[model samples]
Target: MPTREDPLVSFKFGLEIEGKLTGFFTQVSGIGSESEVIQHKVVNSETGETIMQQIPGRLTWTPVTLKRGVTSSMDIWEWRQQVVEGKIGEARTNCSIVAYAQDNTEIARWNFENAWPSKVVGPEMDAGSTNYMIEDVTIVHEGVERVS
Candidate 1:
């Protein structure tokens, strides 16, 4: 008999910076990368058949977006300010995205290096609606690794 694999659910996750908990965000996205494809033509000496070969050129990392309910915390805002003031060198740091299992135990983790916020969008205001306000922060990083 073969055993079945149980996939971990993604609803429970948090962000951490330098081993400090940033927050358990409402949504996280864009944890991915792409490789540039280079095609080359190879001619066969005997058959004269041309073959198109695809090789990877460069790797491009995608920007990760984090979203959460609006709170009094100003950490994300302050981090973005550093970039706005041309202090990007100070802004870059390592952070981790941690995913938890059903019992709230960390099941997986992805770490980002040289990370900084590229954009921060505040929640929209509406006096008539009684919904929780959400803010978004987009971050770009030089590299990423799965720690566990």
Candidate 2:
């Protein structure tokens, strides 16, 4: 049987960027009070392209809706690599876990600059659910990256 003590699902993802680190963003969504999904996307400003994006994977552990005031530490690391189309690539490593409050009424927002391969711990929410396919997501870069 499953218990509340266990998170409903847990998994790690990676994002590949091209060029120097420009900025990154995270949007965490919860089911009720436990952390459900910790999603993030990063952008490279120098070349105006997304350095990294989430690569979907399987969720093994039980999923928990994130709660407010709970802080999960994420160990973020980045590395530069090469890809197709002659585009510079960046690899992002996501580690650790954190929780953000969903009861906050303040405007949700976060900003980063020249911070590549960095881990961000904060509270940000929009909309989320676990019953069905929750589209809760965080878009870091709206641009595109092409490497040869």
Candidate with the greatest TM-score versus the true structure = 1
Q: Write the per-residue lDDT of candidate 2 for residues 10-58, one digit (tens) a residue.
A: 2321222232222222334421112345455677778777665555454
Provide the TM-score for each candidate, comma-separated: 0.94, 0.15
Q: Against the hidden true structure, what lDDT does model 2 obtain?
A: 0.28
**What value of lDDT does candidate 1 attain over all alpha carbons?**
0.92
Q: Model 1: clashing residue pairs?
A: none
**For residues 14-128, could you state the per-residue lDDT of candidate 1 as single tens digits?**
8888789988887889998899999999999999999999999999999999999988989999999999999999999999999987788898999999999999999999999
lDDT of each: 0.92, 0.28
Q: Count the backbone clashes (under 3 Å) in each candidate.
A: 0, 30
Query: What TM-score does structure 2 among the candidates reach?
Result: 0.15
